[model samples]
Target: MTPPAIPPPGVFGHNRSLVTPHYAMMPPAGILPSRLPGFAETVVRFQAAPALGARFAQALLEIGAGGGTTAPRDDGLEHFFYVLDGAVDVTVGGQAQRLGPGGYAFVPPGIAWGLRAEAPAQVAWVKRPYEPLPGVAPPVPRFGNRADVPRDTTNRPGRYIQFLLGTGDLAFDFEMNLMGFEPGSHFPCIETHIMEHGLLMVEGQGNYLLGRDWHEVWTGDFIWMGPFVPQQFYCTGWGPAAYLLYKNVNRDVT
Candidate 1:
């Protein structure tokens, strides 16, 4: 196990809430499942308000057939949703769209959106406060099914990545991406960077280096990596492994 790195300075606030341990790993056991109004059979793994010491919230939402959110209400936050399995009907700003596997949608801050599934489905949602930039408003909601999102090979042809968001000016401050690695593929030696991360294992299993220890992460596991923390991941199972990851981007150095 490698030692943890010093977190970056100037966290979103000088508030004490951001200072927890260097890393967090939430297995299925840590999920205190809940059923809130408008949400049926959903388990929010990390709230980011406390547990993981992050500026965003993420959850593994399991929706039963004919169950979904009730109404659209803006919560002053930006959101990203990706479907891992089954099907869903996501309505963003009054437009209803049907999504199967690899479906994704992004709702900018203050935008109304809702979700429901026809069959049992596993959907991952990541949310964070809309970080406003002077003179620029957040982009309108972007929705699409990523089944065709081309996978660009990483250093190795077998390690591939697909970004659900557009490029250049259209790119939002945060990103949700899907990464796939063939069996035996490995991550970079170690990464210590400014962008923080929230990752959900979507397929297969791998050993991931988070904070000061390496954890064998399988499908359904969740990880939170604070800024400047060392991170790495590798696929060891006979089949390819994949995960949906979130990271804050295009922000100030602080």
Candidate 2:
């Protein structure tokens, strides 16, 4: 009889999770799962929060079929939800819409909102306190999908960007965007800016420069960049790389 084949080890000797004063690189493999108060049958991995030096909170959620919020919730905080896979029904201010992959919705502060998974689903959730600007009215609830947004390729070859939320209006204090890059493409220069960011890698792989270190990141990874921390990205692999980015905008420095 042939000897029994050995199975591979289940545990690795090391992990890739990294944290710094300026940024954090959290791969899905190293994330600790948790539950949220209003959600059921879901796994939540919070990537950025005030405890991590970020003004907003970002979480990646995996919901089982038939699982979601127990009831509508309103915490006086604005929210943005983007579906990464499967199907979900999101309700904002008593209006409900079924969202599939790449679908997204934004709920303004003080409005009631909730979600229910029609199938097993993955989603990115962002929450932040509304920053009021004098003479500017607060933004209203909006919903759309990535397919509906036009990609702007005028910046350069192999690079494209989509502003999911209109940036021309001052009433909007934050922005969510989709950025894509072909293999071997990269940012024109290292960026150091006032706006902090919560970025979720949605597709392909890349080398991301955070502060002074370059880290290999792939799909399902999440990065948090604090204000003025230098950052840049260089795409790798055979296909394209893309990320969903959240940044505070249209507000004066306090």
Maximum-TM-score candidate: 2
Candidate 1 lDDT, 1-254, residue by residue in tens: 98887656534343222224766776655467676665665544443444557888887788888877857345888888888889988888778788888888888887789898878987888888877888887888888877778887847556988788854453378878888999888766788988888888888999888766677888877778888998888898889999888878887765
Q: Relative to the true structure, how large is the alpha-carbon lDDT of every model? A: 0.77, 0.91
Q: If scored against the real structure, what TM-score would every candidate get?
A: 0.85, 0.93
Total residue pair clashes for candidate 1: 0
Best by lDDT: 2
Tens-digit lDDT string for candidate 2 (1-254): 99977644423564567898889999877778998788988999989999999999999899998888946455799999999999999999889999999999999999898899967999999999999887877998999999999998896689999999877688888899999999999988899999999999999999999988889999999999999999999999999999999989988875
Model 2: residue 10 alpha-carbon error in angstroms: 10
* Prediction 2 TM-score vs. true: 0.93
Candidate 1 at residue 107, lDDT?
Answer: 84
Q: Would you list the clashing residue pairs of candidate 2?
A: none
